[model samples]
Target: MEFSVMLELLFSGLLFTLEIFVVTLVGALPLGVPVALARMSKHKWLAWIARIYISVMRGTPLMLQLMAIMFGPYYLFHLNMGPDWKYWACGIGFIINYAAYFAEIYRSGLQSIARGQHEAAEVLGYTRAQAFTRIVLPQVVKRVLPAIGNEVITLVKDTSLAFVLGIMEMFSQAKALAASQVSMVPYAIAALIYWVFNFIVEMALTRVEKQLAYYHD
Candidate 1:
């Protein structure tokens, strides 16, 4: 194919790559909070369940996880998801995998918080919920921003893993074009695209970190 046409195909695939990144963050970032809370819960069962989940997610290969999710329904329930299942499986697998990592990051930030802050908030007539939402959450977010940014950057490249499920994300697009054209240019372009995407993410994250810098623990 012509260079222009190749670029168009790659960009087309980049759109889905971007979608996976956004959807994963949307589903994982907030979902992580509850998992982190559960991990730290006083209730042993909840903590154990969360702990085990985190352990399993972190310990396994994400590609394997994606495969399991993609094929799980057919194997476990004898139900076929048909051709449309790849998109759902891709989103869910990425979300759950990243949620585990984010949960650990959140747990670290939450643990870093001093217990005295909670007591002080209570003394100031703040309910537990108010205290967390008002004071604790902000500090935790600021503290965790760098870690989250790292994960966000990693997710940019991880979107390529969607190919394991036969999703035509950017990398897969480049791979296909390169194979057909017998040229490395497509792969080179894909690298540039990924780097640019990550650069934008880094810039945005740095801006947020600077904004959060107004307060320090």
Candidate 2:
């Protein structure tokens, strides 16, 4: 294939890879906050349930989760594994898996805040909800920014795992093209693409961190 044609195919596949990263972040980050809160809840059962979930998600390999999500429905319920199920399963698996990681990050951030902060909020007549949403959450976000950035970068590379389910992400596409053309050029291009994507994520997160720098503790 011509270089331009090869580039086009790689770019097309890159879009799907980017979709997985973007959707996973968008879905995981918000959902993770509540999961984190539940993990720290006063109620024993709620905290226990959240802890077990986080443990399971963190303990197992993400590829295993993806495979289970992709195949479990058909195996357990005898549902059809249609053509589009791969993307759906991949999206759901990525979101939940990353959410567990994010939840732990969030829990650490939340716990790092001094107990006095919550007491101060209460003394000022703020409800628990108001205290968390207005005061605690902002600081937690600032503190967790670096950790979140690291996970986000990892997610960029992890998008390649979608290939196990037959999804044509960039790495998979590159492998296919390289095999067909008997050239290493496709893999090289894919590497460059992944590097550029991760570079952008790091730069963006650094900018956000700087913006929050003025926020002390």
Candidate 3:
């Protein structure tokens, strides 16, 4: 392939990779909060359900989860596995897996807040919702920003795993190009692309962390 053609193919793959990363983050981050809350709920059944979900998701390999999501519906429920199910399965798998990880990070941040803050909020006539949303969640975000940044960076790289389900992400495109050309240059370019992506993520998250630093003393 010509150099320009190779670059175009890689760029196309990168777009798909970014699509997966963005969708996963959008779906997982907010979904994680509720899962975290359920895990910490006073209700034993809710907490137990959340615990089991987190454990199963965390314990299994994401690649396996992706495969399961792609195939499980057909095998378990006798449903059709259509052509477009690849991206849907990939997106759902990434969302659920990352949500489990984020849930734990959220739980840790929530637990780190001093009980006195909750008490103070209540004493000031704040309802539980107001106290949590207004007083508690902001601090949790500040404390958990670094942890979330780490996960966000990981998700960028994990986008390559979409190839396991035959989605042609950047890394997969590079691999195919390298195989066809019998050169490692494509792989090297892919590595550079991944590094640049993570670098951008780190820089953006650093700015977010700084913005939240006002919450500190």
Candidate 4:
């Protein structure tokens, strides 16, 4: 393959990774916070439900989830799922699966906020909700950014799993190209794409982390 052709194929592969990563984060961020709260709830039933969700998502291999989401509709109901539906199913599955993990990370960060802080808020006559919104959440965000950044980077890598569902993501594109080229050049090019994209993401998240560090309590 020509150098230009290799670059084109590599770019397409990376784009798929980008799509999955962006969609996953969009779904996970707000959803993960709620999940974290649910898992931390004083209500036993609520906590149990949250724990079960997290357990199932974390316990099962993500690929299995993908297989189910991709095929479950037609098999169960004979619904003629469209291409958009497939992406949505995969997106939902990825978001739910990763959100469980992100929730745990957020919960740990929330725990790192001192017990006295909540006590102090209560002493000040702040409602629990007020205390959480006004004080605890900001601190948790600062504490968890590094870990969250780690997950975001990992998500960039995990996008390859989309290929299992026949999504023409970057790795899938590369595999197709590799077969046509009858060589590993396509795979090598794909690796370079991942490296470059992640390096850029790492740098950007590092800057954001530094900017938010001043808020660390």
Q: Which one wins on lDDT?
A: 1
Task: Kindly list the per-residue Cα lDDT of model 1 for residues 45-163, writing each as its tens digit.
Answer: 99999999999999999999999999999999999999999999999999999999999999999999999999999999999999999999899999999999999999999999999
Clashes of 2: 0
Name the candidate, 1 or 3, with the larger lDDT value: 1
Q: Judged by lDDT against the true structure, how good is candidate 2?
A: 0.95
Q: Which stretches of candidate 4 lie over 4 Å from their true place?
A: 122-130
Residue ranges of candidate 2 with Cα displaced over 4 Å: none
Model 4: per-residue Cα lDDT over 110-213, one tens digit each: 98999999999999999999999989988888898889988888888888999888888888888998899898988887887788888999999989878877
lDDT of 3 by residue, 98-204 (tens): 99999999999999999999999999999999999988988999999999999999999899899999999999999999999999988988899999999999999
Per-prediction TM-score: 0.97, 0.95, 0.96, 0.91
Every candidate's lDDT: 0.96, 0.95, 0.95, 0.88
Highest-TM-score candidate: 1
The TM-score measured for candidate 3 stands at: 0.96
- lDDT for model 3 comes to 0.95
By summed lDDT, which 10 consecutive residues of candidate 1 come out lowest?
208-217
Record all residue pairs in model 2 with backbone atoms less than 3 Å apart, i.e. clashing: none
